[model samples]
Target: MEKNKKVVILNILLVGTIILNLFIFTSRMRFFPWFIEDAWGYLGVFLTAPILIGIYFMLRHFHKQQLVTSTNKVIPLFVAATSLIIVFMPTTDFLNIVAIVINAASVFLAANFLFNQNGGKNNYGFSRLKNQS
Candidate 1:
């Protein structure tokens, strides 16, 4: 597959996995009350493993393809950091909502960067900078 197309697909998969992680984390109590009541901490680890693995492999792929721009490199770090925070923090409704919003925003930023046509360039309001001599 073409590189751009592969990146797009990977981004899609990344976003989907993030959403799934959020859903499972937020609703684990309702969906698996027995498991949560018995092993809440382990549940966090179980839920987080896939996301961390996905981020690791995605970063590896980007690095292998020489697509590791500053912006793209930081995107996965932000995703992983926020995900870890969500997993390790004390679980409260407010905290969960806040974490979800932060995670979603980071994911949105990642998607924007991955899908940009200029290859993640930060123009800083100078749209014509690259074209200028």
Candidate 2:
């Protein structure tokens, strides 16, 4: 797939994973007892492992294409680490807030990456300038 397409897919998957995590968190807290069960919350948490792996491969593909910078590469790792913390750590108010902040940061980073893909160039108007003789 094309680079932009791949990035778009990555964003979608990231959002989906975040939503899944939210569902799991809320369900465990009995926020949506009718919609989601505690058992399903466990299942959702387990499902995130593979989704995180997929995100890593997608980022690796971008790295191979030179579309992603070395510094930007660390975002996904941070995201995965935070995600693991969410899974393994006891669910507390502080941890929930932290997870929300991290997820928001990741979304922002993805947006920044998409916009700066062309190095912030605004290519407009005529392509060539005429020289004065």
Q: Name the best candidate (by TM-score).
A: 2
The residue ranges of model 2 lying beyond 4 angstroms of the native Cα positions read 26-42, 124-133
Q: Write the residue-wise lDDT of candidate 1 on 44-86 in tens digits.
A: 5455556656765776677677764555555555656666766
lDDT over C-alpha atoms for residue 126 of model 2: 28
TM-score of the candidate numbered 1?
A: 0.59
Q: On residues 45-120, what C-alpha lDDT tens digit does candidate 2 reach at each position?
A: 6677567667877777787888766645566666667767676876676776677677676767766775565554
Best by lDDT: 2
RMSD score of candidate 1 (Å): 5.8
* Model 1 CA deviation exceeding 4 Å by range: 25-48, 117-133
**TM-scores, one per candidate:** 0.59, 0.66
Clashes of each: 0, 0
